[model samples]
Target: MSRKVIGIVMNGVTGRMGYRQHLVRSILAIREQGGLPLADGRTLWPEPILVGRNAHKLKEIAEQHGLEHWTTSLDEALAHPLAEIYFDAQVTTAREHAIRAAIAAGKHVYTEKPTAETLDSALELARLARDAGVCNGAVQDKLFLPGLLKLKRLVDSGFFGRILSVRGEFGYWVFEGDWQAAQRPSWNYRTQDGGGMILDMFPHWRYVLDNLIAPVQSVYAHTATHIPERVDEQGRTYPATADDAAYGIFELAGGVTAQINSSWAVRVDRDELVEFQIDGTHGSAVAGLRNCRFQHRAATPKPVWNPDLPATESFRSQWQQVPDNGEFDNGFKVQWELFLHHVASGTAYHWDLLEGAKGVQLAELGLRSAAEGRRLDVPELTL
Candidate 1:
């Protein structure tokens, strides 16, 4: 089999998501497996050049991985002719400028969600990439999760006859950083740093709802700063200027309604950190990050509301667990493989920069709906 090496310039490799998901689990894992094998007996090996502001950290990561390339200068890395792909997992506020530069430098760009801080900037990036005729993509990793994949299978198989509504609960109690250090970055609570539940999570919900359920037509949302204060990384206290929680109601194209509650202040009481309960006319299903459960009309028990008598029916026990029929890879890694294939073989990839812009548009409108105390229409972004 013929082998080809694809040089990828990966920025923000020191960040949590970047380091863990994109670099270690995805790219490094692929390298360890001898790269991705194409259908035509060709292998595409990924050679990543770690880039960041901290030279010491970058050097450490490169040395640990036995990778020869590491650089503190982004421009110098981008100028490398072999580095055809530029991947970003940086802070949301810094994404636009870096991506624009990558596109201008004639490199394929792929990045994490909320491609830009605002819809306009996100759209500009999309247009710029299109004008430059470069292949670009954004991370929509949740779609490949095991639970969501099962949910999609059910939807595709018509398990839920005449789908009605979807409810999503996503969050875990983030430590206040007073006694224990916060699990999330301090910037996640500061508005100036492109922090807030709406900006951070709405993009995810937008893609999820649009792809799995239906196209979102409008949204009504309410946001709050449940925890007003938190300590920073250096044990310094600061006011939490961004919304810690958001409750939103979305109207889908086919009269389907979706309610999603995203919060960092809420404690976990469910099966996973994130779960979606979908109810329909014929059946109902609840999907977590790794598992999914379903109850059809034939198996659903009749339970009458009773205030005086003790309830005998076990509602949770009624739903049957969906069995895993196939091996599942890491969600991030699956997308990475697909992106690599697209770059190597000109494969068809639907998730482009325009789709990323739609995510930003939904976030911008969701925040607007929260501030205005009204349901705001989501207009289609055409370009």
Candidate 2:
């Protein structure tokens, strides 16, 4: 019945993802719910100290949230005596240094993925966090999605029975900023800003595959910059130097082959913007961000491949929708609560800096595979 206030140094809240998902939907939501309930009949209340390069934006967000602390100086925020955790959701290029500083300051760290631009730097961050003995974690929120959770349940129930393959389709057309305002930031299309489809998405695929299906063993990829130019927020034209699309084939540890296509130029044709279809010997399932449908081997439709005849059966109707047995909260919020609990009670958290480094490794190997036009084996990292 007592409450313990935990100060968290929240950096990069000015960015879109940082503002919406991590700050508003997760941390602030938890605060509105009377903090996170601990097992010892106490509440772990989170008080975030917003930090970023944009002093105006930081001040604005702090005022809007009715928060008392907002600072442009990371040093000042880190030096706060109550600051137990440092959370980063900044642009990829700016993440490593801030995290290093946080580790050196002896604060527990949590961050969004692509922990560093390269595998070496990412591993170094992991090593530093390990050596510092801080409770560190990287965001892997996709694993907490309702559809993926249901898919994991099916897998755990042996419904897949000798899983065979996975096919993932993720992307939607991002408008060229000149004609229509782009949904994503212009930095996402620039190579120098640590942006590209491979770097942005391969890390996600890494964790999803390793945790839900099997560990990735190798990868073959091809990437392209479909749009050559785009306008920035200031209405100035800039060359798009990063890949907008990436097609990859991954081999998993259990011999499962996963083919994924990520693109910003392709229009969405599926039920959701992102979907993964997993096939196994006994059954097959298609899972979107919110829904999952499955077809047993016996119920699968058989279609004739005659080009002359008209198709008669409804292929989509043959699958059964998976029932939602429980209410699902926001995935980001769920992870935030878990990480908070880990800090408060020494709970075991699997998605550590090492797991995040694996993601960076996948992205680096994927890019190399695309450049060399050859399959690259993913070597395990030790630290």
Candidate 3:
């Protein structure tokens, strides 16, 4: 079988998510597995040319992975004839310019979202890619999660007939950098550096709700900065100007409603860091990152509200676990492979730059809704 090696200009590998998920788990894992097989008895292999700001860190990463190509210059990396794809896992602020440059260089673009800091910029990127006739995509990794996959299966099978409402809880306490090192980077809490819970997470919520449930019609949100000050990496305290917590109620098409609360200040009390419970006419399901539990209308228990009576029913045990019918791969890796296939063989991919732009739009509107303290309608995006 013939083997095709596609060079990918991988930007922002020094960061945590970039380093661990995209670099090691997805791309390198594909290389380790002898490449992805194609329909024509061929193999599609990825050659990642590391690109980042820090030469020392890039060199260290390259050597650790036994890779040859490494460069700090985007122009130089894009100039390489073998580099057909440009992948960006950089911060939100740096993404738009890099993607624009990639589009100008006639390279297929794939990036972690929010694709741009604003809706206009995101749409501009989409328009540029379309005009350039280059393939583009944004990372929507949550859809491929095992729990979400099972939840999707139930949705597709009409398990939750005539879906009514969904409740989602997603967050964990990010240690304010004084007592202990924060799990996330400091930039995540800074507004000037493209930080905030709304900008960071509304994009994810957009795609998840749009794909899994229904299109979001309107949003009513309230946001706050629960933590006023936090220590930085260098042990200096800085004002946390960005909102750390956001409570949103989304009105979906067909009268479906979804209420999701995202916060970095809250401690976990559920089965997973992120979970969504979907309730419908026929049954209800609660899905986490890897597991989904369901309770049918017939099996659902009835309990009367009594302030004096002690609770006896084991409510948690009423729901049955959804069995893993098949092996589940890494969500990021799966999307990477799909995008690779799309680039290689002209495969139909719906999650393009336009889709990414929609996500940006959602975030913009969500922030506006929070500011106004009123519901805002989600307008349909074109081009």
Best by lDDT: 3
Clashing pairs in 3: none
lDDT digits (tens) for residues 160-190 of candidate 1 = 9999999999999999999888999999999
**TM-score, structure 3 vs. true:** 0.99
Which of the two, 2 or 3, has more lDDT? 3
> What lDDT is reached at residue 183 by model 2?
98
TM-score of 2: 0.99
Model 1 TM: 0.99
* Residue 208 of model 2, lDDT score: 97
RMSD per model, one decimal: 0.7, 0.7, 0.6
Better model by lDDT: candidate 1 vs candidate 3 = 3
Candidate 3, number of clashes = 0
Error of 3 at 120 (Å): 0.4
Off by over 4 Å in 2: none
Compared with the true structure, all predictions reach lDDT values of 0.94, 0.95, 0.95
TM-score, one value per model? 0.99, 0.99, 0.99
lDDT pick, better of 1 and 2: 2
Ranking by lDDT: 3, 2, 1
